[model samples]
Target chain A: MNIFAPVGRAFFTLLAQIGRLTMFLVEVVSSCFRPPIYWYHIGQQMMRIGYFSLPVVGLTAFFTGGALALQIYLGGNRYGAEAIVPQIVVLGITRELGPVIAGLMVAGRVAAAIAAEIGTMRVTEQIDALTTLATNPIKYLVVPRLIAAVVTMPILVAIGDSIGVMGGYIVSTQSLGFSSGIYLKNTLDFMKNEDVISGLYKAAAFGFIIALMGCYNGFNSKGGAQGVGAATTNAVVTASILILAANYFLTSILFAK
Target chain B: MTTPKIELRGVKKRFGPKVVLDGIDLVINPGESLVVIGGSGTGKSVTIKCVLGILRPDEGKIFVDGEEVTHINGRARDKVLRKFGMLFQGAALFDSLTVWENVAFGLIQGRGMGRRQARDIAVEKLAKVGLGSEVINLSPSELSGGMQKRVGLARAIAADPDIIFFDEPTTGLDPIMADIINDLIVDTVKDVGATTLSITHDMASARKIADRIAMLYKGKIIWHGPVSEIDNSGNPYVDQFIHGRAEGPIKMEVRG
Candidate 1:
């Protein structure tokens, strides 16, 4: 009983955290439909969460695409199948690596940023000040970030998908002795619209997870500087983990056939 | 008799096992300033938070202008909040915004006023607090502590709210600046004709701004009276606190 007690407590704590996150999500989503959408704030957040994240997301995708092509070429050489590198690279980048890498990178960059900013506001009584000013903090802060993330993530993933395929193309043509026209033809012929759409859907879900985790941790942050730092760490960690987990589930459901 | 501007009846609040407010019953009349004075961690801030709906009381009833508002939510809560303004202890001005924008935030964001009109009103409010046009475009971080408090005061009064709250209005300023802030609070409250509730341990700030004083000790109101009567309130806790005496019925918890 004594040993089970710790397990029971930990289980309940996890349940409590899940419950809190769910409620926070419901509130933010509901606020989206209400009046006072704060179009200005949504635009600002889109610039921050989407535009500012482009360089990092693009660079990561490019590198991952190059590495994936290299790995597939080397692995396929043993089977005399190196000619399939372009096809494999395009399929993998568009379907998996592009959205996942972009999500992870943005989760590290944007989630930590959102958490630190909102957590500082929380500790310094700015959030309470918002309340007294007849403003809802969730509506004022969280909804805009959520909306911007949901809207811009698909765009980012789309761009990253193109850049990633370009990365594989460059590697295959310049280093692997494959002709540019043939590699391009293979990639174009192998890629499907459903693959791209599925990845975009995954990007949107990851964006929601990133913003939601950031805002939830930030809103619940307490103490002072240390509390905010902890919130930032927690936000990135939770978002990254959730993105991977959600990817697996989404992939299973979307590609069940 | 006129209905009290604000009233708390058996308002109790606790955090976990630690009770911060122990069944407080208080009233603030219309157009009067009431200051609650106590040492740190005496639940003075919590009392104000309860009234503001920033922190809900565990057990209580709170009323504003004779309307019960303890458990209201959503639009009703925002409707109630429209009548209030607050100056936080840290003078929590939004550091991201320019000084005038900080002052105009509640106006532009809460009431949806046009930006140009809100900026004009913000500048006027700043001038009322003795801030000139030169400081309008600067960020809150660029201002001195006293200037920040002035900007905070300007923001608090910008909406012309019916009730204003001052949380440690003179916490970090030098004696001269504290006095200046006190004078500003007095002038602004009078100008707006708003009932005010303030909490502080600064006796000078209390004496200068409060029409009436309440002494909170151990989460309860130990003594309350008009400012004229605070010095002679006769309760040992009140006597010890107001006079700044270390040795009396009050005991300081020196853990070290």
Candidate 2:
């Protein structure tokens, strides 16, 4: 075998995958602009992706916020900066932990579900059936999920942010012996609207990543049960990785001095 | 002379190093049922898919209603597809949708019919396939294999399409259910006055439903004749296939 054959093959395979994904993204974006928007389907997806995902996202954010407070308290104690817990906790939860944690959680929940559902549809020819029935599968399947995730993720994250902040406040005042009024005052004083807004922006981007990865994997899935299962796992893993990667770039862009 | 309802001229398709269809040419006259019979992996499905525009042929032309449809896409493809209906091997019903909704899906989604009116038409079509009103509201997942095939047939004829394609319609069913489905397909095609192109390995299904039969071997139509003449076609491949013989001119690919 040629020394460079394997490398060349791998490189071309990567390029081909990128090309296919770009085309898929273009189709999805183009379809979104077209008419016959299925508002009913969109609403249903919002319920599935946004509403049903709430408790998990909320619970994750709550625990994260509480743990963050405890950690900050312990670490700050070494420097006689224990009182900084409220400000740091609020800032961390709003600006980073809240959106990222909720995103990962929903990536695990919603992205896997979307991939499994659509992948099964593909293997079973229901997607083809949709095409034969005159319904564009992208319009009926991908667009609704895409629109719902983009619209609802920020809302979900915003709610999660609130719950997270509340968790921090409760843990600090109740267990850390911090005064409730002082903690609230410090949290509000330390946090800028931009911090919260940036997180919401990240939430929206993460939502798009999750839905795109899921739909892309699912639509391209072949074979049968094994294919669907692989698609589901791939969707969650790829979406979670993309969320984190996008978060870094978004953070730099949004918060650069 | 009127043009054949659907015609394939020297169509060819390949997947990587493997060639699924080398060169295929066939025709189905208006309102006639043509069954393309072949063993597994003979590109029978590929032939139907090429004509349906699901898979594009690398060479040659496909004409539906005398119009060249080889390279059509977008809205033009949809317009071409509107004249066609298909029942896939596994019924392919939407598990999310109820039986009636599956039947009326094309009407509502494709033709812009209101749900209520589409539902009414769906019920009527379902009844034609001997399904009662009670089954209409049930999900396809709730139905038996035979019942799902009936629903599939109902959905196929729901739009009264100009052409219909059946891809192994009797697959995964008991022999009795298979015969029942074959009878229903014959009756429904007659009711709609639709041309049909079906592909199956089952000789019984081919005999019962085909007006004209074509045998696809190695991606080429090796034999084509009227159903009555299939018995005396004198093609060893056809004889071996119909008789389900393991030892014949057509060798089965098996490993010890």
- On DockQ, the candidate that comes out on top is 1
Regions of candidate 2 where Cα sits further than 4 Å from its true position: A1-3, B254-256
Steric overlap count per candidate: 0, 0
Model 1: CA > 4 A from native: B253-256
Tens digits of per-residue lDDT for model 2, A157-189: 999999999998889999999999999999999
* iRMS of each prediction: 0.7, 0.9
Residue-wise C-alpha lDDT for candidate 2, range B35-72, written one tens digit per residue: 99998988998888788777899999999999999999
Model 1 lDDT per residue over A1-257, tens place: 48999999999999998898888888888999998888989999999999999999999999889998899999999999999999899889888999999999999999999999999999999999999988899999999999899899999999999899888888888899999889988888988899999999999999999999999999999999999999999999999999999999999999999
Best candidate (score: lDDT): 1
